[model samples]
Target: MSEPREQRAARFKAALMKSGARSDTSLYEHLVRLLSRVREEQPQDPVDVLEEMSRELKRGALQQDRGALRDVPATTPGQWLAEQQRALFSHARDEDEDDLVETPLPNLAEVAFFFQQAGVGLGGEEMQKVSLALRQLSDARPLRSCRFWGKVLGTEANYLVAECREAEPPGGAGGEGPGEGGDEDAAKMIVPPSTYKAPPVVPAEERGTGTNSSAYFVCREPGLPWTRLPDVVPAHITAARRIRKLFTGRLDAPVTSYPPFPGAEAEYLRAQIARISSGTQVSPLGFYHLQEEDEEEDEDEEQGTTRGRVEENPDFEPLPVTAMSKSLSAWVHHVPHILTQGRCVWVNPAEKPAAEPDEDEEEEEEPDEPEREEGPALFTPLSEDAEMDRLPPWSSRLSSALVPRFAVAYVRSNLWPGAHAYARGRKFQNVYIGWGVKSDAAFSPALPPDPQREFPGGPEVTEEADPTPQEERALRAAAEDKDETEDETEEDEDTE
Candidate 1:
């Protein structure tokens, strides 16, 4: 006996209807792939085969979702897994953050708590999320130090930036140091060019406010990956100053605006972070002192730059927060202004090298010469706050400029728009909250004052001249007489 096709179809339908099961897209795709494999193998036990396939698919997806731990060598499995666990968003704790090393991390929770008084603080829940994100970042990467850079709000979404000091790359900055070369035959003898066509400025100390001083990472959401932003090139910084647009929150989004930018949103964001930090990041007067001379030869040699760095002042006496909050000059800008050519230090290429004066002669004339200019102080005073649309550019106050213990200085910058900073004693915190926009010189579009009118006599002043009845009659009589005189003169000319 043989079964007909119609009979087989009827039997399958009856069984499917009785089971009352619905197949979704995920299940359908899985089954389709499984059936293809089964048909190829002509499996003996389909049930056992399906179970094995399911396990394999699950394992592959797990690896894709939770990334493979970075920087883990072929070591103990348990230990590596533990490290992966630490490098997750949930590793953050309620207490303050601390590194196993002595480097003290900025406490975001406390900053949020203190800055709330100024009305610019990111709320408690958001700050907690940021803490978790930062914790995961520090654990994931080989970081020497990391801190919360401010939040930049975007139209579609927002970016929470993390500033980090990364471990130096292998082979050092120049690729391989002199010692790394194998032998005389293997190594190539090289020397720097005697001079450059356009010689670069002497770069400032690496640890201070140099170009791309620290690494910056941005993330839209706490669960999302922390993307290391591209470095800010000079051209990008110059362009960013001219154009002002809100971040789209997409790293690869094209910048379709005027004075076309080179890269994408990542480049634009990096330039903005540099500008904001330079303008609003400040500290108390003596909080940071400039290093007059190089101290350690090892660090100077490693970085390959002369030392004109900024260091923490260990012996700084606490300034009264009440007095400090009364004026803007009490604080000083720690970051250097990005010059027009997009550099911190300017270089004069035309000047030739000069011979050094004798030590004895220099000492003899030291008392006679005028005081020298120390190329823009490592820390300069914050400029006077200006007024915008009648409102002050900066609002400074203390929780109570009276109480010493609770007195914390809070200054909100209107120039950079939503930048805020708070200082108590030694510890200080700064954060930004609005869209990344620097305030324009004028709030509304300015048209020239209708241009001054061409009036020479200051202004044309006219008064309504009134006439009495007598004056009106006299004017009418004069008009009639003038008409008669004109008629007589015309007749005389015709007769002649």
Candidate 2:
């Protein structure tokens, strides 16, 4: 039999006290107090939570060491020296690990902005260089450009060394040429044009002049590495239309903007957005500062009268990105997927009713039953209700969750490292609201690309004039005399 209600309540109270909760009076009062305490304890936000977890895991790993290794005896001097070296190496590695306790995680909005900056040059020269490097690596050929390795590989140590032979003359006997089965050989050796076609160059004067500039091709064909649409159908137009609706006029706006709703609708949406963004069921409603009533209004109305009192706006104060709107929250969760998902579809409920036999047809069918086949059934059809039930809910079909998994995989395989590196190098300011460190540097807008400008972040190489033979000889004689004088001065100083 189940325990009595009073006994259960007492047990629960005792459990709470055991778990570091304080009780002042009755169990009911204790529960209310415990709930209030839990509500007050809002730990770090999602970004900081990830950072804290990472730090704790690292610290735990570092704390765990083999005590037995310390007690092990070395049989020879060389072995002892080797053991000492290993210990030193381990100590150095531990020292190199970062202490994340003092460092705070970056703001989500700043991270979004950094990603936006990285995606800007996807169809530019940077992408072309990356594509070229990919082709070389796939073909097991030596990379021709050191700059490519630096930009794409992050460091020279990451570059793979390959031994490739030089191609023979085109006209030589048994040599490949355009007319002599060279086309087939070329096709085998080179990357497909559809996979790596460079974006067309637009002249500065002609750019943003017409609709032609607006058109962009995400993929050459509608299949894997692009869209999951059938070969006969065009996916680009459908994908573009859905994506336009998904984002609308929201991407360019800051998260602080209030939802265009009054009263309860705004409050409900805000609460939902907050819950989804933080991945938590319960959160504080946030603090509100009540405004004082006007003296004239107070005088007009009797004391304790609410007649002629103005109602305060529920959403007058601005909220952070985490508590903004559902659209923004969904975007944060699925940014990488959103960028690559070529097409999306929303399933509409069927309007037409299931077909029923007519009166005459029913009468005719009753006249005689057809002979049943003896073999096993090839296929079975589901009932109308069952089929309908199997379909996903309308909400799940929204762009947020409808993005194909393949698109995300493609992005991770192709674009992740470069984008990550780019974002990692830049500074993330305003980490916690308008708080944290203040920088002295003035912000300057990035300039549009110009061919005449020097290569970015690279030193200019200038050719120096060569010295004549007479000048070279004179310089050598001066260097020798200077060395001799320095030696004599050193000898004099020693004597003194």
Candidate 3:
């Protein structure tokens, strides 16, 4: 029987080899596990067992390949698989398509100018916010008649030609051009070519006769002459009017600043005062690239301060962009508004600006009285919120003057409260509806709780009342004595 089985098995092996079967030893272990499971489930049928083994061997080979390639890079799984994909796509390749790539575009300086113009026109809350920022950043400089432009072109050389009008004569010199006229007319005139004959050349000696001599005519390097644009004052004023509109009718409303509260309030007030006194003119002398300066130290300090409190204080608030603008104007002009009126008070009457008052106006004025000076405290708190509703007449006028120079935009109410919640696990998210920011000069929150006192803990043994008590011999003896006496009395009763 054993000899017959061996002969059958040998014949089967020879048949497998002849049919081009390949050895797959890597999947041998998996094949064995599969055979074991099959043998356990179907112990009697050898034919079924063999069929199951064949099917499991195929599955084992697939699983073994997956396991072997598990650590391979995702880009390419197997050489054979990659080759097959390449073969499929390679069959339909297109050769006629152009390979030329488009070049990236260039940035233009004129675009920045256009944005500046457009931003001025936005003229609303954003304008006021911008004005306030500008006022805070403003500095003094001499009157600048020309705005210098860089990166001009050859054909665009004519743009600066009109700017040469200041050097021209009062009535305008008669040049060879067809339409030369008075100074005003010449300023607006366009010269048309009168003749083809070699143009009547104006000598160098005659160049400054008409429009070239006045200081109003801009001067710059001939090679890169600056292009002069119209003054932005009118645009600035328009934007400022927009800003004024936000606060003019609503003095009682609250405002926010960018830096949040406390520190920001002080910083903003200081910057605002600086802006008012300095004005908006920038000095070309000190102009330097921001990248060239060593700002690391200043930045580090700012970061240190901002990082700590900003995330922790929930009640922190900022000034409104509109208020910052108004504040600057009020301070610069010595105008009294809701905040400024009570703060900057009056400069000494004698120190007042020289004014030639009308006789009738002077007659109506009261005699000079001793001016009250501020005590040790520079500022006193307002009696009530109602007192902040009005501004003295002088403050209104000064703010109006600053209207041409600065614009404010984007007046946010507060840096959303997170400061209190971050350091403490205490959550503070809700903001009061229609709540307004007021000066903290009058009130501030309690100091944070002591850290050590708040979180003390440790393991220690503590005594608790125990209901179980140890037996006492003395107490038991007394109980036994009482029991014996009772028994003796019962015996006497029985005897009676």
Candidate 4:
């Protein structure tokens, strides 16, 4: 015969506590070990023992909370047991619900565009499911707000300009101030659209021919439009400003180019490339397109005479063609890949490498091997798969120009202390406007007029030559026909 269930449960509970099983996993292992020992000691059914132990534990719990249990009316044993089982199951279901994590949704427009471009077919139901998933993902994440500031250049129709420099504290002195600066500083910073000037022209001799060459003389001829943004701008703008600030004094600083607008710069580049490849023109806010038109001459005299005409049409401009020189094609193509796969390295300029000691100094120094000390690690070691899982998505990393906007925000908040405070207190805006074309002299001359072929005694006169025998015979026949036609017309008039 088996011992009383209460006695067995009390002994088991004591053993469980003694085993030091604090976590659920350890508790389960301990319970399994205890059951194995009980099986070895007796030939009794393990199921019956387990059931009895459960009942004993439940009774003990009820006894511990006897005061609370007494408040409820007593019921038949069968009904009470049923109610307890139902409650236990319901609690377990709730726990399961809490543990479940929902999947994120994708952007529907992007998804549709991708599928359409890839030539992939999707059924109606499948598309509906994808759209639903995208909705769920979008709903899960909050939207981020962005701000931009720069100048508009060229004819409003066909123009190319850069919107560099995010809004920053107005003054060069970095300190806390009256959040609002003087009106004069604000006036200087906020350049109106109509007043923005075209990019200043540096002579070719001064500008040099290097792609990474620094501007020797920035043409400051004021006429083009300029825009100034207030402090506390959008995340992307803050990132752009921070990056530009980082390279302030370094002449050989790395070139970090960002898109004029917000969001994934790679996506923008890809779309631009696709549009240009398809022969469809794209004109962003301040860029112009150069189109070639053919002019036709009088067809009767010169049947196939046509001349090539190159014209600038502000209304239709492709970004790649207008924004930068053709030499930047490689860089443009490489930008998307870097944004997706590259990681940023933060190096402190103040830190320098230690110099090597002389041979005499090395001989005088004492040799010592430091003893290794053992200590608990602060961070848990992660497997390769886990580390890969922790990495951000490509889209997220490349969502903004140069570096991700979030990374920039992090740098500002952590590395550049007081930057946030300074930005918040300042009322004035900082804007950097760059134009594509400075002056006619800055650019290479257009194709020179085709060299005219010189003939001896100037251009030959084809009409000066006398008519051939065949031509003369035809002319005489035409004259005789005209005379006959006139005579017939006169005869008809007389008969009438």
Which one is best on TM-score?
A: 1
C-alpha positional error of residue 325 in candidate 1 after TM-score superposition, expressed in Å? 1.2
The per-model lDDT (C-alpha) reads 0.69, 0.27, 0.28, 0.29
Candidate 4 lDDT, tens digit per residue, 1-496? Answer: 9899999999887666653322223354546755765666673677668766645544443334335535676698667545543422222345454334332322334433333322322434434433443232223333221111112232222111111221221333211122223577766886646533332121111111111011111111112222121111122322332222111212122334432323232222212222111111111222222232334335412422122222333453333311221122211110101111110111122333477877776554433433322221111111111112243111101112443222111001111111110000111111212221111222232344577666446346545779999999999999999999999999999999
What lDDT score goes with residue 450 in model 1?
52
Measured over all alpha carbons after superposition, the RMSD of each candidate to the real structure, in angstroms, is 19.7, 40.7, 34.8, 35.4
TM-score of each candidate structure, all chains considered together: 0.56, 0.13, 0.15, 0.15
Off by over 4 Å in 1: 1-104, 169-209, 295-306, 348-376, 383-393, 401-405, 442-496
Best by lDDT: 1
Q: What TM-score does candidate 4 get on C-alpha atoms?
A: 0.15
Report the C-alpha displacement of residue 142, candidate 2, in angstroms.
42
> Model 3 over residues 1-496: C-alpha lDDT tens digits?
3669888998876654452224344344454666677777776776766776777666665634434655765555455444533432222255334421221111213323222322312234322322222221111112212121111112112111111123223342322222212388765788885443432222111222211121221111122222222221111221221221111112122324211222212122222222121121111111111222244557635532111110122343433334433432211111112111112222233333467877776455444664544322111111111222242211111122345233321111121111000000121111111111222233334455555443344455445554433446667878999999999999999999
How high is the lDDT of residue 119 in model 3? 31
lDDT of 1 by residue, 1-496 (tens): 8999999998875554452133222444555666777788777888877889766654554434122444546778556545554544443465455454344356777877778765666778767877777877876788777888788888777898888878763321211211222677534668565432443332222332355677889888665678988666566776788687889888888887776776689888988888888778888878888775646756755543335667789998768888678887878887776666555544332343577877776453223332222234456666553466776667777876356568688787878888888888887877877788898765342233455455344335655679999999999999999999999999999999
* Candidate 2, residue 471: how far the Cα is off, in Å: 99
Model 4 segments more than 4 A misplaced: 1-58, 61-118, 121-126, 130-496
* Residue ranges of candidate 3 with Cα displaced over 4 Å: 1-471
